[model samples]
Target: MNANMRAAAPTEVLRYTAFSADPDGGNPAGVVLDASALDDAARLAVAAEVGYSETAFLTPAPQGTEGAPEGRAFTTRYFSPLAEVAFCGHATIATAVALGERIGPGELLFLTPAGPIPVTVVGGDGESGPRATLSSVEPHSEPVEDKDLTEALAALGWARGDLDPEIPPRIAFGGNDHLVLAVTSRERLGALDYDFERLKELMLRLGLTTLQLVWRESAGVFHVRDPFPVGGVREDPATGAAAAAFGGYARELGIVPEESRFTLHQGEDMGRPGELTVDLRAGDPRVHVSGTAARIG
Candidate 1:
């Protein structure tokens, strides 16, 4: 270990659940408000200790960095138990709400490895607590290769005929890459059994963070689940990043109107139900994901 790693100061890690008002409903995330004294190794250690799917570490941004106003801009990094990811939606929302409690709700800028993310927090003092809306970077989707899709289905123990033909398989990118797969029935979606090692290998090989397993309930309502073996977690209760990527995928594929809003209900199968709201504007390519978070002891 290096000198900095050895002498790392203890930091306070705040626990909060994102995408739901109830702490027990959403995805739990660890937030390190000030990670200035910790190095990369120390940060990862904290995340592993917290044992959530992901954690957010915030350090002060460099002076005069664009879009980073004083006292509100931060260079944030997301780390899973196994590795550092480019971006994490739930952690970002959790961190924003945590900051909102301390600094009041409004706009905050986070410089992430993926890109600059703009987050807005509102109604912190209300009965529901703070709700955060994160505007993702420009998003795009592309068709997945035949071989890769076949391999994914096999690892998932799903047949090709089980897929929803309306939404073709595609790799979508908002903050990170997720393979979007829409199923024909909610029963298929709930029966979450997969070969963890095999799926993790495929995800790591394809630079995928999670597989966005979804079942469309209506034109604007959907039930979603994410298999996140790559993050050392079998499933992510509520995945903000995947939700944002799915929004882009829906818009790009014309599954929904150019300007539309949709609801994604996740974590129900895990007994931790959470709701995510995704909005797409007519002229804007970026997707907006909004949800409420609550502090967890």
Candidate 2:
């Protein structure tokens, strides 16, 4: 065996679905409670073996890490079938729920590559499983370059007229960067046929993790879809990172009030429906994404 392979220790990986209480719904993610002995190659291998879009690996954080409670802090990393990403929302939620089941629901801290993420876990009573709320790091948005936007649209086979002029196009950042494009109608949003290689090239050049395609249903509700070619997944059922970034984008552009709560419906087109709740506080620039998760038997 190779040195890297030999260095990997057999660790227990928990499988869970985030953003939905039903196991068949939501996005499935693999969570490793103790990956301290696993190397990058090992982690990648595990993620590929699990066949999920993303998997979270957790190692105990150093004692007294800032903002972390004495026994509830962990250093976390995310890996997809193809590569390691700076952050992943669904995987984070799945990991938190898995931890909650073992340690009892409470406040927990995760030191991720993007930044420190504070998560609160509650419930696990009766039939409903544990729910987790993760507060993202400060979010921001920047205008999408004209050339990049054009290229992106071309990859998706979409015309400029199909875009929602009200929302505009922007590159938003929560934990990872995402290209936000609001479609004019739900029909246009549902017809998501994109050139995989072309979009992947554009995403890599722009340092984007996914394309957050959205269609507003009402003042506080929207249907969202994420094409994650960069992560080697065709689509993400429920994307927490993109939801957080979208909240920031909306607040930054005044599409929503300073303090507002919104619901994001995702994965419906893929048949695995899930819901994500986004909360924007008046004074805090950070976005909070909350959802429920259940173990997949």
Candidate 3:
């Protein structure tokens, strides 16, 4: 693999862990703070070398691309180890927090292929570390056909009875697309052995970012696992994009109140436990996901 980042401008790659205060507890992402001169190939090479599920490339907003001021707003792109993706939440959070440390905590706009995203960074007090919250694009969910659900279950090695009847399968979109599958029990959710190639083919055909496997723990707490085959990763420790999509799915399906807040526990099965806070407002269709990030050496 060509794993090299070469360009004229400064191309420092910052490493950080998103969705947890501990460096080893959350999803790790590579953040390129200034990638103005890097081409797509160079960015991809850098991401491959970083060996993270996703790496974010940031540059100043180009002229006439959007109304964003040159230095204030950024044009961002996300690349996995294999290819580029429309959006990636964990990397976005890591990038936001990295920018926050340099520019001070505030709001920053990122122009992504999915759309314009608004991210707010808050400085941490003595009690907590720096955190970032991203508001997703208008989210929507569509019913999943029986055939698709059946095929997905087969790839996941799960039977129909293992699924949670209350939360039906659906395709949810919050910046990126995700297949939301709710399991009946935590045990069922924990045993995740899937046909990677088969699932990757299905996801590629359907343009899905990840399979959001979930189990509702209580009224507001849930456990989630994301199988990201297309990204060249077996599983994502903490998936903020999937969490946002799942929040939208839960709200639209009436599983939760229109205006509600929920907690998602993820990566525990993988030993990198993370906590993501999801919020859904009554009037707004967008989903908000919040998590802390820490720099990693």
lDDT digits (tens) for residues 11-111 of candidate 3: 68999999998888889999998888789999999999999999999988777655564455898999999999999999999999999899888888899
Q: Which lDDT tens digits does candidate 1 get at residues 149-241?
A: 999999999999999999899999989999999999999999989999999999999999999999999999999999999989999999999
| lDDT-better candidate, 2 vs 3 | 2
> Candidate 1: lDDT over CA atoms?
0.94
Query: How much RMSD separates candidate 3 from the native structure?
Result: 3.5
| Candidate 3 C-alpha error for residue 273, in Å | 0.6
How far off is residue 39 in model 3, in Å? 0.5
lDDT of 2 by residue, 1-297 (tens): 766575534678899999999999999999999998889999999999998999999999988797887788999999999999998999999999998888888999999999999999997667768889999999999999999999999999999999999999999999999999999899999999999999999999999999999999998999999999988999999999999999999999999999999999999999999999999999998999999998999
RMSD of each: 2.6, 2.6, 3.5
lDDT of 2 at 19: 98
Off by over 4 Å in 1: 1-8
TM-score of model 3 vs. true structure: 0.94
Could you estimate the TM-score for every candidate?
0.96, 0.96, 0.94
- State residue 112's C-alpha deviation in candidate 3, in Å: 0.4
Given candidate 2, what's the lDDT at residue 18? Answer: 97
Q: What is the lDDT of residue 223 in candidate 2?
A: 97
